[model samples]
Target: MGVTGIGGFFFRAKDPKALAAWYAEHLGVGAGPYGHWDTQAGPSVFSPFAADTDYFAADRQWMLNLRAEGLDDLCAALRAAGIEVITQADWDMPGVGRFARIHDPEGNAIELWEPAG
Candidate 1:
C-alpha cells in the first residue's frame, strides 16, 4: 500500500469528550461514520504523549500528525528514512485500529493509529 492520507487527530483536553462533542457540534467532526472531515486514505496519527515529555510544550497546544495509508508501510518508510518506530502488541487496536508509536526529533511522543473499518 502507498501513503495516501490521514484519518483523525486526537489530543488531550481538560474535557476531551466535551471538546470532541464541541468539535462535533461546532466543527462537526463526530457526526457519525462519515464526519465533517473524513479521511479515506493517507495516515491518521494516534500519538499519546508522556505526561512529562517536553515534546508537547507547556504552551504549545497541538501535536503535529501526518496521516498514512498503512502503519506497516509508513513504519517501513520511517525505518528506511532512519527514523525509530516503536511497536508493541498493546498498541495494536485492531478491533479499533492499528497503531504505532514514535517520537519526533524533539522527543515528543507520536502515535500513528489506523481506525477499523
Candidate 2:
C-alpha cells in the first residue's frame, strides 16, 4: 500500500525543550520523547509552493499548516494568552476554511486552519 499519512515532523529547534513546552502549553501539541497526538480524522494538504510565493515570509523555507476546529474560540484563547495571532479577511475562502497565522518563539510560521462546515 502507498504511504498512509504523515508519520512525523522533525525539525531543528534552537531550544527544543522550551519550544516543545510552548507548543504543548499554547496549542496543546504533545511534546517530549514518546509524545504523540491523535488528531481528528480530516483532510490534509500536501502541496508545494512556488519558489517566489508571497503567501508567507520569504525568509522561511517552509510553513506549517494545521487543521483545527473552533477557529474563533482558539484564536480568542491564543490572544488571551498574550500570543500574537494574525488574521486577514481575504484569507478566508467561502467553501474552504478560515485561516490564522502565528509564529513560534523561534519565528517559525504556523498557519492554523479551520475548514468550513
Give the clash count for model 2: 0
For residues 7-110, what per-residue lDDT tens digits would candidate 1 score against the true structure?
44555557656555544542234576533465454334456766676644665555554334567887887787677887878656655777676655445455
For residues 1-117, could you state the per-residue lDDT of candidate 2 as single tens digits? 998888778899999888889998988887545557777888889999999999989998899998998989999999999889999999999999999999999999999999999
Query: What's the residue-level lDDT of 33 in candidate 1?
Result: 51
lDDT of 2: 0.90
Candidate that would win on lDDT: 2
Instruction: Looking at model 2, report the run of 10 residues with the lowest lDDT sum.
Output: 30-39
Residue 100 deviation, candidate 2, in Å?
0.5
TM-score of each: 0.46, 0.95
Cα error, residue 69 of model 2, in Å, equals 0.9
TM-score of 1: 0.46
